[model samples]
Target: MNIRPMEYVNRERINRSKQLIFLEPEQKIQDISMRSGFEHPSYFCTVFKRLEGMTPEQFKKSHGFGI
Candidate 1:
């Protein structure tokens, strides 16, 4: 089953989370989840990976701390 409204919200939320991931690499994924409108951290991880093409940790490690 597909949900149009939910999909739209999901996309918007994913974009915001991507920004958070870039702007706050020091923050843990759970923090990002809470800040980005997600109540569940594990669910955030799953959805984030699906949309962003990589896990949050991998994104941070790839571009964080000057490397």
Candidate 2:
């Protein structure tokens, strides 16, 4: 792959998190981060916002999965 190893991991982590976002709409970001293989929720949110253009909370709300 052309991407760096960390980049690949980050993308995979984000992808996994996205699935959880839809599957567990009511789940908290911290829990979602943990379930998605992230060691820290804050880092997960940071990457999520960077890639998706919105925080996980925002993404969830935007998709009608959260309040």
Candidate 3:
């Protein structure tokens, strides 16, 4: 499986986002998004929803985060 550089970066970003969500679930979604290298919170939410099948807030809540 040959992965392009951009694809690898994107994958890493998404993985990082997931880890951050678990690590700091109480943090604001926008903060997490930006920390994960997403330029805009909305874009992050869109991509996250598309890839994870739920919004970041939903994911957090599902994981037992109060947010």
On TM-score, the leading prediction is 2
Supply the global lDDT for candidate 1. Answer: 0.79
With a 3 Å backbone cut-off (N, CA, C), the pairs that clash in candidate 3 are none
State the lDDT of candidate 2 residue by residue for 1-67, as single tens digits: 8989998899899999999889888888899999988899999989888888999988888888854
TM-score of each: 0.79, 0.92, 0.84
How much does candidate 3 score in TM-score?
A: 0.84
CA displacement after TM-score superposition, residue 24 of candidate 1 (Å): 1.8
In order, the Cα lDDT scores of the candidates are 0.79, 0.89, 0.87
| Highest-scoring model, lDDT | 2
Q: Give the per-residue lDDT digits (tens) of candidate 3, residues 1-67.
A: 4978876776678789999989988789999999999999998888788778999899888988988
Model 1: C-alpha RMSD to truth?
Answer: 3.1
Ranking by lDDT: 2, 3, 1
Residue 50 C-alpha lDDT in model 1: 87
Off-target runs (Cα >4 Å) in candidate 1 are 1-3, 65-67
Q: 1 or 2, which is superior by TM-score?
A: 2
